[model samples]
Target: MKNNFYDQNIHYQFPETFWWGSAASGPQTEGAALIDGRKQSIWDYWYSVEPERFHNRVGPEHTSDFYHRFKEDIKLMKETGHNSFRTSIQWSRLIPDGFGEVNEKAVAFYNSVIDEMLANDIEPFVNLYHFDMPMCMQEKGGWESREVVDGFVNYAETCFRLFGGRVKYWFTFNEPIVPVEAGYLYNLHYPNVTDFKRAATVTHHTIVAHARAVEAFKKLNLAGKIGIILNLTPSYPRSQESGDVAAAHISNLFFNRSFLDPVTKGEYPSDLVELLKERNLLPAVEAGDMEVIRNNPVDLLGVNYYQPRRVKARKEPEPENAPFMPEHLFDPYIMPGRKINPHRGWEICEEVIYDIMVDLRDHYGNIPFFISENGMGVEGEEKFRNEEVVIEDDYRIEFVKEHLKWVHKGIQEGANCLGYHIWTFMDNWSWTNSYKNRYGLVEVDLKNGLKRTIKKSGRWYKQLAVNNGF
Candidate 1:
């Protein structure tokens, strides 16, 4: 939270081979949601049924229209000094039926997008899923059903065979735990189930799907590295007391290590497993699921750090008839004087990124990783527009600079960190919240036909990319 985290006098040059770019997803950016053989995803279905849940009643059907304007967008990416970019392939678009023939038009569109990026000298980092499940698959018990897992594996294999030759950085899932938490636990996403047991199954099956996809990617002998993107929020105890520390430990087990350990270390944290077993909330794992997860570990990792989680020992007893939840083990501890993002209501603890890097270096073999998604999403950013019609978003530039300083320090300390990609390249649609908070280097004016204008941060980012530092 200190303003002195970034010393302007220091020339923090990154490696020459560092990737410089940002990330966006198909579901959030690509419009033409139901066109050219595209089918409905969970977002589409949820919007149709409960449009009121979305901000201003806006749905996913008409996003930033990336489908039609990708060529223009790639040009903007180049203008902003993007050498590498990450985005997801919509499963519903690629395989509309979820278990049937591929959609050739969708194939043509994605191929064009990838080819366009290649032509623009931009490397494409394609993710397989981004919380966008096909409605048909969701109808078939979603992630709870093993059949859906097999279908997802098939879909991933199809993508590998189709686009693996050009795209060298592939991600199996973007924040796989988000769906498990949002849809199953928090009721923030579609199917709005609040059952912890069901949530456990969903989480397990998602890991199974990821491992199977990694297995498939390796089997294909593709010229690409496959991994998963995880949003890791490091948990901090309110105090160093034994009870509070134990609470933080359990919090880490549920939120961070549950996925991190299995994908990287090839198994779940033993204590996490024991905890779940003791609660009778363990997911149904098949005989060879563990082997699949163990044998096929990710070749790379994409970390998205936004904030740290503060926790303390639970002070309240759970009612006997209450549904079980992770919150039962700990209570959220709001640290006094902690910096907060008023727009998003998230704490701003920039040092957590360095802590994450050091932890990975010490405990997780220092696996090759990158800052996959980091940015500040501000509401009513138009208020910051200058006379030049550019958003003078100095705050975003400071946010990136501060985080990158910690990233540079981590690299200096021998963390195998590779690159940093902001949360998005352009302002695009977000889930439920829609475009309520703008987080982009380039501004997309939805009121003006999604007009694309480079923000001041975009200019700064270009210089940062060119200089390999700020």
Candidate 2:
């Protein structure tokens, strides 16, 4: 029944050069967290003190054992028809003390991974940071301190000097705003503080850090593109009413344009800056910080679209003493009978992908970009396995096909979208959520020696890539 969804469909062919692969990170996939001079990261420290905060108390130390199994994993990646893949260099692993001598073991491991991927015809897109800050840097006030920013710049330079020749695409950060919102504002991440002002400071410093990295990349003259990955959640109004429209606009200004404008336009959105300033929530900026940000815009963009943000006007005024939050400006709007991904609690709005592409085409100069991360995460997937032991994830296949249809429409309508990479290649540890929500083309059976098995969707993905589309 599920397979019939693809029958008699209009062929959606992508460009011959479209990238087909997935994204993962060192901390999330690479086990051996405490070996070969790799020191503690914020995740390690957080899990140490507050194990209860993580799902099932499963920490980040021993994830998928990719450190020892990357060869096998890379082979699996090829089996899934990956022409390119994105992963991050662990800051804690590279420079265990946050700044100083390079860890030779770490260097060797990364060199091997890059070489192996190249050998397999996989273009490696290396990212510098993925929310895995070195513990030593966090102790120095994380992104709130200039010194740590400088350290990150040095680390970026080191990575460029070492692996720049092979890596033609580099990213400064993955979802840079997540640390600010999760760690500083929402208390969902490490050092969970709930202060808007501090969050604002972290946000500023992170941009500075990213720009500095971009500056470093430019100086090195590496023959590659440098960019950042943003999990873009397009904001939608509950109704066309003026109040709801205003609320949605405000939400977009705060969440989307705050980082999007700065990186792409090389300046923070004027409206966002004024809003922060009027509320006395703007962070202190150094004299040259804006200059750096304005000068070093990204060369490409990676959009991770999981859900759309639906907002409406606040139903009531905030309490006089209540602390500020993004929600204070808007209220969440739950549309009746909206499709949702139950495991992740996110709306499954396939058209939003096209909306994002149209937005880029009309407003963002049609920047060269790709679907850096998009996939479905289902809990307890073993229930869907067949007698062959392969998980028949028809829902996942439908999910990708639906999104790709919109993506193809956007391209046909003149959006500068390049390629698509799923959220991940295989199941691995996902921060505090652990392995609870699996979002992988390949299954990692934790109960069976971390074995790898391609799901039914993965088999279809190979043909999708071979044909360039479905």
Candidate 3:
């Protein structure tokens, strides 16, 4: 059945050099635990202790098995019109102890993957860390300790010396803020501590580590660009009321500016610093740190836009003398009427991508950027499976097209936007959610030992790449 929904006139053409690909992480996709000298990460430890917390009791071991299947998976990348592909290096796999002695098997495996990607005409964008710190490092305070920062520098330097010639695009970290919030404050990740102070400390150390890694990459003179992938959530006030606007600004400062200012501008926002200081929650910083951060600016920025945050002034005050929370300064309010992703429960607000790019250009001097991750995760995807191995995922197709349109708008408006890479290439295990949320263009059949089946969206995306648009 030919389904032609997007009018050709409405589709905007992309540049010839635009990156058409998908992104995945080592922890989320690779599932060869205890194989080829790979060591356990924080995730491996967490799932072992509490398998019940994961959906379907599936742990890190049941991912897409990319560790053993990269050769086959790279073939799928070529089939799916991926001229470029992004994947992360597992920290534990590279440096099992988080510092010394590179695992020769891990190095050989990554070299094979990179070589395969190059052979298939797929540009490999490799990220250094993706929320998979080795268990040894976590036991010794993880990102909170300065020693971990030094270890990270060593690990990054090792990668540059080993694979720098082949891998051209290097990313320092992917969404560093998530760990601070989820692990340290919200109790969602490993070493789950509900201490705001630790969260602040971890966040600071991560930035410092990023700066150190960038410094190491430059010192080693690696022949590539080094950048960080940030999940940018543009915040909007619920109404035009002054209080509502103020609330939105604070939310933006905490979530966006907190990282952006330090990475791009070399300092944290004064207002955010003041707010934290007033609440006695400022991060500890040493002299010369600001200089290092300022001097080592990123070459590019990866924007991962999923949804916009609609915020308003808190309707009620926190319990008298309660601990500080983001909500203490602002409240997230649901807009009365907006398009929503029923499959994933995320608001389908495409315009936010454009707004975010504009904000970046207006505030951050228009550094070259790309949509690093964007995709829709649907539940119960098997229902749409056809006999020919096709899954009618029109919703996913629509999600990509809508977001690309706004991304095109940003490019046209001088946003220095480079390209768009979807969140995933195939259905792999998600953290906590496991495989419940399917964001892949290719569906993985878990019951059948992770059989790969390309979905309807994959075919649609291929044509989009072939034509540069719909």
Among the numbered candidates, top lDDT falls to 1
lDDT tens digits by residue: candidate 1, 294-388 = 99999999999999999999998755678889999899999999999999999988999999999999999999999999999999999999998
- Which parts of model 1 have CA positions greater than 4 angstroms off? 1-10
Taken over the whole model, the C-alpha lDDT of each candidate is: 0.94, 0.93, 0.88
Error of 2 at 86 (Å): 0.5
Number of the candidate with higher lDDT, 1 or 2:
1
- Predicted candidate 2 versus true structure: per-residue lDDT over 123-176, tens digit per residue: 999999999999999999999889999999999999999999999999999998
What total of clashing residue pairs does each candidate reach? 0, 0, 0
Candidate 3: Cα lDDT at 79? 82
lDDT of each residue in 4-123, candidate 3, tens digit only: 433366368888899999999998998897788888998899999998988888899758999889999999988888999999999899889887888999989999999999999999
Off by over 4 Å in 2: 1-10
Give residue 368's error in model 2 in angstroms.
Answer: 0.5
